[model samples]
Target: MENVMLRDVIVDDLPIFFEQQKDMTANFMAAFTTKDPADKVAFKAHWEKILNNEAIIKKTVIFNEKVAGHVSSFEQFGEREVSYWIGREYWGRGVATKALSQFLDCITIRPLYARAVKDNIASIRVLEKCGFEIKGEDKGYSNARAEEVEEYILKLS
Candidate 1:
């Protein structure tokens, strides 16, 4: 489990977060990703906006005292949805499961929602393990893969 922990994301964490998201394999698995992962300017601008927003619940996923990735909640299409990213090097070993479990405890908003690429079993398993139930399914254009992909929608109520 690597003593996974979640804490408020700080400005210093942006570089690591950006680097992690740039991983081709991780972004492909996530499916829904920035239009250009390599665009540092865009990444910085995006994070700046997200971090400054008070309505968002953002956290850095720490493992063994190092930044493993990030987990956050934000509104999309009038729904409060959750999302997380785990560095490719730390994939598996239950990092995502532990981080989400801990993160869920800090968030009290009921009927929380989450989504994952249908083919991303690792992410689906993490959400399911944290008590998110499969609610529905939909298809969307995945910028990371540059194609349409099935996405699983889940909720915690």
Candidate 2:
């Protein structure tokens, strides 16, 4: 993957990014997602909260100069957690792995954390390749699945 880089997300990127996140397959694989992915008003408000907040680290994942997806980290229950969304078109191209490697370098916070739906082997593999270790498991409500899902928690020190 050439030209894979992480850059500060801009307002113009939100629409594109939100569309990527709204993919039903991607949302199902991720398990946790916005209550209603199609609501532009809600999507805009959500991105606004993320972009305006100083604590969140937001970045656009560029692949060969095209907007491929996004990788970002935010605090959950006082633990910083990694999360990402890859456009369905970009899946299986190693974009997530490459972009994740670069994003980890920019986030220096130690003992970082991440989670993945138990069946999402691809996402778990990306986190593991980046040096995050599976620490435990927990159940959470998945808005996309409309049910509780088993999630694996990982940690990096």
Candidate 3:
């Protein structure tokens, strides 16, 4: 895989972002979300908030000179953590790992954290490859799944 770069997500990227998210959300719901997409206006609103917020570090993952995915770090419940997603087409090509590694390098803070759905092996592997250790597990409502799901917590020290 070519070097993956992380750059700030601009306003123009919203369309691509929305499409990728819709696809990922649909896939995630196969085993998780019970509600119809029609009832998920709030979910779209959340992404809009991320897009408009200046405090949240939103980034686009660029691979082979194209937008391959997104990665971000933000504060939640007083803790800073990272998260990312790569299009299914780009999976298994190291795009996510490379993008996340570069993102981690830019984070000066120690003890950053990350979380992944318990069943998402690929995401777990990506976090692990970036030096995040599994710290624990917790139950939370995943909007994509629309139900309480087990999630793994990872910490970088």
Task: Please report the candidate that would top lDDT against the real structure.
Answer: 1
**134-155: candidate 2 lDDT, tens digit per residue:** 9999999999999999999999
Clashing pairs in 2: none
Top-scoring candidate (TM-score): 1
lDDT of 2 at 115: 90
Estimated TM-score for each candidate: 0.97, 0.97, 0.84
lDDT of 2 at 70: 90
TM-score of 2: 0.97
Predictions ranked by lDDT, top down? Answer: 1, 2, 3
**Which of 1 and 3 is the better model by TM-score?**
1
Clashing pairs in 1: none
The local distance difference test score of model 3 is 0.78
Off by over 4 Å in 3: 24-45
lDDT (Cα, tens digit) per residue for candidate 1, span 102-129: 9899999989999999999989999999
lDDT (Cα, tens digit) per residue for candidate 3, span 57-126 = 8799988888887888999768898878777678889998999899888888878898778888888898
Candidate numbers, best TM-score first, in rank order:
1, 2, 3
